[model samples]
Target chain A: MSEVQLTSDLIQWKDGAADWEEAIRVSAAPLLQQGNIAESYIDAMVENIRTLGPYILIAPNVALPHARPEMGVSEAGIALTVFNEDVAFPAGHDNKTQTARIFICLAAVDSDSHLSLLQGISQWIDNSELLNRLLEASSKDEVKDLINQYS
Target chain B: MKILCVCGMGFGSSLMLKMTADKVIKKKGLKATVEATDIGTAGSTPVDLILTNNEFASQLKGGKSEVRAVVNVASEEEVEKAINDFLESQ
Candidate 1:
């Protein structure tokens, strides 16, 4: 398969979420509307964190929320939601909660495809300065440009 | 050395850990076979260390393998430290 670059329409900027579940819902809303993923995928993403803890926060202030493709993924895509204030996920390390300002919801066609999406996110996260800039970015185009520069 | 990157469903975060492990291990000029698997399979497979986030580490304990609860899956520094720390003890 070829590399996937996230489109600008799939990106959204928000102020904050009431909680983590809402954050996942807010992050995945674009994918659901695009028919890239089913609503069940959103529920599954939230369920994973509820059961397995906040494993999605791969880097500081960043998260890649995802579920098994078999659950409800129709197409391989990523939806990004940048929050002004960080949203917290439950049961993180040291009995404290994990929070993130950037939430990238991943929908892979199969088990094998998530790695590609993972590869893309890894580059953006590898540079903490870029990630911090992402949080500071003023517009969706800026966010897309920054991500495009790396992934 | 064999390293198993185990997660709840072996789909999301485990893959990231596997990627970092593969890169860090290769950079260190070490020979190792690393795989990402679900929790059920991880318990049955024998490996030197079972690497995962801190939350899943407790459930993966009491088994044959030693569990290292990693704080950051995408950090090369964290992963390299985990790998070197594990290799030195062996």
Candidate 2:
């Protein structure tokens, strides 16, 4: 299977977001514009969190927001949005707070296509240095370069 | 052993956790099969163990297989430790 590339058009570097829901919407905006996903997909993502809790905060500083393809996915795509400030999600079952500054919204048509994409994303999330660079990146090109370098 | 990695959507977080768990299982030389599925399907599927985050883990309470709650699904270190601890207990 071919791996999906993180194009510059899908990367957004901004000061921050108002809340987790807005963060997901802002991150998913690129995918919406690219026609890979519809607006309902974004709502589904937020609703999934509401129903299932903040399990999307997969790591210390990264959140992978996604919903079922049947929700409203047109094509398989990934969007990255970095925030200068932290966005908090609901407390976990243990009552521990979870926060993230980087939101990566995933729009997958099926389970098969997302494996390679998750592999690439896991590489970045595992690397502290690379993740730091990505969080601090100022431009889309810089973010794309980092993704290419690590992915 | 059959291990199921579960998340709300099945396509996103669970898949990521499965990938990380696969690496940890292989590196640790554990003899277990890992699969990813949605929370809804996970309840019906028969598996030896279930790996998921805290929220989903709670939903699986009183289920057939043992449920493991991973604090950080994205961290290989955390995943490796959780799998290893479970395997050692078995």
Candidate 3:
């Protein structure tokens, strides 16, 4: 799938919420509202952060938070976010070190699709230049444009 | 062939790896079934191979099937490479 197929307007972030939970909540809230995910799914994902720390902080500026599809997923897509300010996952070794400005929460039907999407995402995250550009993105249009370039 | 991919929660990363595997396998014209299992249910799945990331691969119980640890938690290339490496060795 192309970047357009993977993202939507819901993934954009406007405010820089100080609390990491709030940042995640803001990023994923829209998808939840549109019935893309069960309400509990959002809670489960946020709880992972609270409990496991920022283990999903896979790279320098990006964080991917997701739960099982069984939690709630009717479709296959990705929710994107750009945090206005850095937010920290306290307990991680990268604790306070890896603050994500870009968040991509994936929702898929099963393991196979989830894996493919994550792999697509990994290809984007693995690129140092693209990641930096994602962080620097000031608007949703810019973010989408950047992702379009890569995806 | 049946492939079982496991992770800590069988939720996020594990599922992602499974998707990539299925895609690659399908692309290569291999008929296979792939599922993601958490470490909790790894014993229940009937799979010929196990694909997992860094820390999670180490947790599997000794069994008759083969196991591979893909380099990154989420790299299709790594997963493909691992599978190719396994196939070559076999």
Candidate 2's docking class is medium
> Which digits, one per residue and each the tens of the lDDT, describe model 3 over residues B1-90?
788887657766666677678777977787888887676787666678888743345445366667887644455567788778767877
TM-score of chain A of 1: 0.91
**Which 10 residues in a row give candidate 1 chain B its minimum summed lDDT?**
B53-62
* i-RMS, each model, one decimal: 2.2, 1.8, 4.6
Reference-based lDDT, each prediction: 0.83, 0.84, 0.70
Q: Tell me how far candidate 2 lies from the true structure as C-alpha RMSD in angstroms.
A: 2.2
Clashes of 3: 7
Cα error, candidate 1, residue B79 (Å): 1.1
Error of 2 at A20 (Å): 0.9
If candidate 3 were superposed on the true structure by all CA atoms, what would the RMSD be? 5.0
Candidate 2 segments whose C-alpha is farther than 4 A from its true place: A138-141
Interface RMSD of 2: 1.8
For model 1, the DockQ equals 0.59
Candidate 3, B-chain TM: 0.85
DockQ of each: 0.59, 0.64, 0.16
Pairs in clash, predicted candidate 2: none
